[model samples]
Target chain A: MNKVWWKILGSVLVIYTAIAGLLLGVPRLPILNESIRNLYFHVPMWFAMIVLFSISVFYSVKSLSSKSEIDDIKAVESVNAGIIFGLLGLVTGAIWAKYTWGQFWSFDPKQNFAAISVLLYFAYLILRNAIDEEQKRAKISAIYNIFAFPMMVVLLFVLPRLKDSLHPGNGGNPGFNSYDLDSRMRMVFYPACLGWILIGYWVYTIRFRIRSIEVKQQAN
Target chain B: MKKILFSLLLTLATVQLFAQDNGVEMADKLRSDGKIYVVVLCIVIILFGLLAYLFSIDKRLKKIEKENFPKN
Candidate 1:
């Protein structure tokens, strides 16, 4: 976790993606046109968010089992990092929607659900702050994190698909995999997802370290 | 009336086919003009700057951790 090699690799891969994503030949589909390239920049935000939230839930479960304050801190920091990525996903999705879907906020099922899931995390953070006792706060919030993770998955992955949505992989619309995401695009897209995920983890670790240090200082 | 409606439908179908045949408009001209590189360079610079800042923060945090927790 402390290794520097992965961090360096993540930076290199992201730089490569930024360059290649713009230069690479993408599928020329009507309506989507050049904006299809946004798949590289926009979609990865949600991927990173999901990965970070998964990490948060893992730590949350560990905290519940062990009753450790550090584990609780880890869970909270991961959620904090995940929320940043989620917001980025929302903003980028909105911008992409504006050109393609004809509006910034279309009240699409996917968009509405994404927003609600983010609000759900916001509630977790608020719930954490509402508690005054240390162990009590950690225990309650960890349990909340456990519930929030699955709800987030259902909100993002399941509910949207059940209803009509302008977003891909939902409603009647075909996902990028069925068409458009050809070999040429995959070269950049996969690396972009991985690079962003690594970067998200890096940010989470940094926040965790800083928070840990602050906790130690308070104790001393 | 049926003939007229059928002809109109055929015309609409031909127009759709023609649109597809023309192909989806991409930024081919921008690529050929060699200006896309400029945008790529600008984004790379911004990314580099952000990563550098993050690394510096990590380095400083490591220094503080070392000073505070010598045993660790």
Candidate 2:
């Protein structure tokens, strides 16, 4: 697709997926019953959060090592987007929990880990704001951002794997793998994930552009 | 001040949550599927897209900067 066409396509896909996710994915799931449909929205938000956070880390590393102002902007914008997606993920997950787990906020290991990840990233933003010097802010935030990224990965992925739990997919609980998620569900779920993620990217790009403009205006 | 406020909010949340059931273990079990790798892959793809967009923005900004501040 041409550039304009690509942008149009992205926007269309986002709208289409959102409608499909709500209308179809949530209602038509068979395996794990209707509750499993939460994956369509909640899972994608988490995925977007991870993606944006990793980009923040990359920019952080680049900014610190090379002292590139552009890198710092990217790092900041990525973190902002990551925070937004993380909050969405948490909220949606909580709603899903209220229905399935019969509670809103649980101290489950994964949930705690998720919360810690959010707090750590939020602190990264605060650290950036606290520093006065541009270079120093970039350098310090970069280091912390890198550190936070891996910590989140371990908390959300590795640590949970090492334990058995009350969650559905953990502790040898029967999950999507063994569960009978049919082809119909997969159609809506995969696209929904992609569409939300693309929408996330659109937001990040817009924010990044705005930051870049601000930097240019400041320079002038 | 914001930090202090956040901490106080967090503390309140923790206390309130403690009064209720802590379903972390169960929630973990429910969400801890092998689909994590799929999540990782999706994350990587999104990152690449964002990175590419950032690079393009930087280039565009540099062009604008040169236009506005031509160092003659």
Instruction: Identify the candidate with maximal lDDT.
Output: 1
DockQ, all candidates in order: 0.57, 0.02
The clash numbers for all candidates, in the given order, read 0, 11
iRMSD per prediction, in order: 0.5, 8.6
Q: What is the C-alpha lDDT profile of model 2 across A65-169, one tens digit per residue?
A: 789898999988988988999999888888877777777887766677788889998898899889999878888888888888999999887776667744656
- Which 10 residues in a row give candidate 1 chain A its minimum summed lDDT? A172-181
Per-residue accuracy of model 1 over B1-72 as CA lDDT, tens digit each: 999999999998788566555766665554564688779989999999999999999999999999888997
The first chain of model 1 has a TM-score of 0.99
Give the runs in model 1 whose Cα sits over 4 Å from its true position. B1-34
Interface RMSD of 1: 0.5
lDDT of 1 by residue, A42-69 (tens): 9999999999999999999999889999
lDDT of 2: 0.72
